[model samples]
Target chain A: MPYNVDAVFQIAGIGIIVAMIHTILKQMGKEDWAHWVTLIGFIIVLFMVAMLIRDLFQTIKNVFLFHS
Target chain B: MIQVVGLGVVATILILLVKEQKPMFAFLLATFVGIVIFLTVIGKITEILKVLAHLANQAKVNQFFLETILKIIGIAYIAEFGAQVTRDAGQGTIAAKIELAGKILIMVMAIPIIITIIETIINILP
Candidate 1:
């Protein structure tokens, strides 16, 4: 409905935290864990975006009368 | 209106902050903000279209033609939004392809309108 200002901050926070964890893990010689952390963080953000996109497309189809 | 501007500025600042550490997140944030802005404005767009449709009906315009035109407009808007987002991510080639696809689809939708106009013109000449 309204603009989601919180989502912007939430994503930024996740990115910062993920980057920090990744660097820390790499420094500790756990490259695999670092990659995993990045992957998981990306997937989380992707899920959030996927839901938003779905809503967007649905609204478009309804407004434009895309019966298909 | 102010809210949309505020959201854009805030998102831009946040994107910049995230870009230094994670460029991928920056791109996703850009896309997320874009979708949010579009979603927020869509309601207003629907209201405007409703008013236009009501006016068209009062004027006895063909409903099928109006529907086709609206579909064309929607396709253009979607294609432009998608291309701009893709370009924001530095994929100029993909953005161009998206635009091309949109143009073709719009032309396809406009074919019936074009045929109708041609038919009207031919009938008037007789």
Candidate 2:
């Protein structure tokens, strides 16, 4: 299967946006908010990656196991 | 493969750019890129495994042994991946522990095959 080029773009875009927001908040002296924003952004990206990892594991199980 | 490489290069550049101002975000970006690369190549890995299984079947290898070996390999790959990610996050001690666990699990998985080999050797010896 060909790679999903869009996923890469999506992740990088999210990272950039999150970093921008984090910087803005930090510069404004809202350190707590900045941290939370960065955390949330990281979690959002992590959720997407986690789902992909799950699918990968499912495929691996199907390939490696005889009963599956 | 080309797509993954391209994505990885982009991510590396972004991480380098962000690291000075925001180290935490840089780490997250690195990890996200790693996962993306892993996800993209997983399909090809499954295909290779399927081909290997087919070849093993054609050779009349024991199904159980083949399955066990495959599982062990999968465990090793996953453990190493996890360990490396943890290492990248700056937890070198945790990464070492992860690798140690993986090694122990792999040895446990191989015990049955080892026993069988020893048994066969004993039978052949005078």
Candidate 3:
């Protein structure tokens, strides 16, 4: 299977946008909102990684444990 | 391989750009790219192991021994990947603990082979 390079772009785009929002909010003097934005961005990226990890674990199980 | 390296380079650039303002996100980006790279190469790893197993079978090596060795290697790689990711997230203590667990698991898995070796040595002596 070919690697899905788009996923990397998608994640990086989210990170960049979130960072932008955070800086904008902080400049506007809303530090609390800036922090929340950063947290949300982190959680979104985390969810994506969590799914990838689940897939990795399943592959590992099939590869290492149940030798067909 | 080239594709994976390109992706990593792009991710690294992005992470560097984001690190100043959002260090947490930068760390997450690094971890995500690491896993993505691993996943992309996993198919190649499986293919290589299958070829190795076939060669071992042809050479009259014990299948069980080959399988155990492969499993131990898999555990080591997975555990190292996990620990490194944890360390990248700034949890050095937890990373060390993960390494300890992997070593313990490897020792447990190797016991049967160790016993076989010892038994063979005993049989050959005097």
Candidate 4:
């Protein structure tokens, strides 16, 4: 996939939104919800990064003639 | 090139803005941006390598040597990227280990060429 800045923006937006939710939930005395929100956000970003990393490794292997 | 720089700068600002509240996200953002930059330039690198390979073929250079050299370059690039990301995440020891591994792998990759050179010298002497 072509490199797009949209992923970066999406990740940053998620981070900001998650943080906001976490703060609001914690202030509401729902600490568990806050943690869950943060965890979900992190997982989403992790998946995105993992896919990108896989693409990168594939490209590197193809360019460098790495068969295994 | 300019687009890559602009993305980096924008990512940097976003990372800073997010860092105070979510350091993990900031780290992820850093990694994501790094990958994006690498991927963006990868096409150019591939084109350059293709041109280099064509030139080497024209020069009658050993294909084996060219392939090994390209592998070494790829390893170095990957290792550097890994080390930098780890360093950014504040894992100095892991970064150092990654670099050491890269160096060792490179040396291993060169051994065949080294042996060939020695054998060639021996044949020349006889």
lDDT of 2 by residue, B3-109 (tens): 66777788788778767766766776676677667766777777888798889999998887888898788778778888988899889999999999989999998
Candidate 1: where is the Cα deviation over 4 Å?
A66-68
Two-chain complex of model 2, DockQ on C-alpha atoms against the true structure: 0.40
TM-score of 4: 0.95
Candidate 2 RMSD computed on C-alpha atoms after optimal superposition onto the true structure: 2.5
Candidate 2 residue lDDT tens string, A1-68: 43455665676677777778888988999999988987887788778767766765666566555354
Worst 10 residues of 1 chain B by lDDT: B69-78
DockQ-based class of model 3: medium
Ranking by lDDT: 4, 1, 3, 2
Residue by residue across B35-91, what tens digits does model 1's lDDT show?
999989999999999999999999999999889988988898889988998899899
lDDT of each: 0.91, 0.76, 0.83, 0.93
Of models 1 and 2, which has the larger TM-score?
1
**Which residue runs of candidate 3 sit more than 4 Å off their true CA positions?**
none
Cα lDDT for residue A67, candidate 2? 58
Give candidates' CA RMSD values in order: 1.2, 2.5, 1.9, 1.5
Number of the predicted model whose lDDT against the real structure is largest: 4
Query: Considering chain A alone, what is the TM-score of candidate 3?
Result: 0.89
Instruction: Give the alpha carbon lDDT tens digit for every residue of B28-116 in model 3.
Output: 77877887788888888889888988899999999889888887887898899899999998899999999999999999989999999
Which candidate number would show the highest DockQ if scored against the true structure?
A: 1
Candidates arranged by TM-score, highest first: 1, 4, 3, 2
